[model samples]
Every structure is written in C-alpha cells, then in structure tokens.
Target: MADIQDFKSTPKYETFSYLPPMTPEKIRRQIAYLVSQGWNPGIEHVEPARASAYYWYMWKLPMFGEQSVDVIIAELEACHRAHPGNHVRLIGYDNYSQSQGTSFVVFRGK
Candidate 1:
C-alpha cells in the first residue's frame, strides 16, 4: 500500500465493498465509528442470494474534516496498511453519502 500521506492528499477514497455471509460485528462498529468521523460507507445486504467466500471487508480511511482530512487519512492509512488483513469494508458514495470533497479508503476480505 502507498504511504498514508498519499491517501490523505488524494481527493477520492479508494473505496470497496462486499456481499458475504457474516455479521462481522467488530468491523461494523469500526465502520460506524469511521462514518461518524466523516467518511462514506457502502451499501450492505444481509446475506444476499449469491454465495460468497467467508464474510469480510477492508478499506482505506477517508478524510472527515478539511483540517483533519490529511491527518486522519494519514493516520488511518498507516493503520490500515500496517495490517491489510484487518479492517473491513468501507462504505461507498451513495444518496446518503457525505460530501464530494471527503475521501475514503475502502477494501474487503473473505
């Protein structure tokens, strides 16, 4: 993964999503926390019809505030990259998503 600073500078988030068969409570909380901080989250389905690998998710940390955007993204980028296999999926931009300026780091796992 690239340096966290790179992530922070970027205007768009490297977002991702998943549709697996798992609750992933811990990740859900983390995601919610990030969203509260000012990041966009992707739409999720409860055990969709299509079969998939084990349920998992991961994503780049997006900037929440203008002043803290770089700082937040850098910090989260370091943490996320330090352990790629950890963080779950990050929400993508949608109707209820945040502003266009905000950026997010997104990923998923199985």
Candidate 2:
C-alpha cells in the first residue's frame, strides 16, 4: 500500500523549473543568449503562492530592440530589490516569430 502522507507535490513553473535555482552568472549567460538572438527581454514577477496563476505582473514595458546585457541585468536587479518576496522571471520575445521564445525564473521567492 502507498502512503498518501508521504507523497509530495512540487509545483513546477516555466523553463528550468526541474533544475536548481539559477545563480547570477547563469542568469547573465541566459540574458546574453537572448540578446544575441535578437529577442526582446522582459521581466515579470509574482508571489510564490500565485506562481501557478495564468499571468504574472510585468515589471515594465518590454525592452524591445535592447542589446545591452548589462542594462537587462540592472533592470532584473531593480525588480528583485522592489519585490524581494516575489518570484522573478526573465522572458524572451522573438520578434521574427511574433511570440515568446523562452522564459525562466531568475529568482525564487519565499
């Protein structure tokens, strides 16, 4: 017989959910890739409890045509500072495909 009490259901978010939390270096690498691909970068955040919700609050307008990885990192850090208790994610918008190309959590909140 199986014990229901022993079963744990962990919620998985977007990309990289199965892996460990990303470090600052990993995040920078990802942002660099996005920039290299000519994809627009955007920041979104939500409370951990509401991570499963359909939509997260966008930090600001997407950085369309932005090419500086440093600027993106700065914005990400700013978002983290404002919402230290929220889960922060970085998303890449592919202009060629007219859709989102990738998304992953950069910061996991309590």
Candidate 3:
C-alpha cells in the first residue's frame, strides 16, 4: 500500500511569504530600501479570501519622486485603516525595467 500524506498545504503570497510577519522596524527598512533603489512605491489591498486573485485595489497613485520612508509608512497605515479586513501589500516598481522589482504583504487580514 502507498503511504498516506498527512501534511496540509498553505498558500504563499508575495515576497517574505515564507518568513514570519514583519515588524514595524523591518517594514521601515524595506521602505528605505525601496527609496534607495529609486523604485516607485505603491500600495494595494484585497480581501484575504481573494488574496490569490490576479488584481488588488490600489490605495492611491504610486509615490513618484518621494524619498521619505515616513511618508510611505503613513500611506500604508492609512490604507490599513480604510481596509481593516483586507490584506495589504507594498510593491516597488522599477521604472528603468518597467516591471515590478519587489512585492510583499505588509498587513494580513483577519
């Protein structure tokens, strides 16, 4: 007889999905890296159930030419406030490459 599988599978999202939840300090560091790389930052949110969907709702226009990590964090907080039950993610868009350079979940919905 074949052996039976006993483990369950979990869905993995964007960057850092395999790691534990990030702290505020860690998040700030990530934002700083984004700024240092000159990549535009954007926020998007979606319900936990629909997190695997192809699209998410944009919080606002990407912060172009903004170098302040504080500003980015504030915007992320605001998006969380507006969508407390949604999974929120921060994405870094590379203008030169015209593609997304980094993406990670900043907040997980209940």
Model 2 residue 80 lDDT?
94
lDDT of 3 by residue, 6-107 (tens): 235356787587666678999999999999999999999999899896699999899898899999999999999999999899999999999998999998
Off by over 4 Å in 3: 1-10
lDDT of 2: 0.87
Better of 1 and 3 by TM-score: 3
For model 2, the stretches where C-alpha displacement exceeds 4 angstroms are 1-9
**Model 3 — which ten-residue stretch has the worst lDDT?**
1-10
Clashes of each: 17, 0, 0
Better of 1 and 3 by lDDT: 3
Worst lDDT window (10 residues) for model 2? 1-10
- How many pairs of residues collide in model 2? 0
* Index of the highest-TM-score prediction: 3
My TM-score estimates for the predictions, one after another, are 0.26, 0.87, 0.89
Q: Give all candidate RMSDs, comma-separated.
A: 13.2, 4.9, 5.4
Task: Give the per-residue lDDT digits (tens) of candidate 1, residues 1-110.
Answer: 33234434333213322222234454445555655655444322112212134443333433333233344334544555665554423343433443442222333322
Better of 1 and 2 by TM-score: 2
How are the candidates ranked when ordered by TM-score, highest leading?
3, 2, 1
Candidate 1: which stretches are off by over 4 Å? 1-66, 88-105
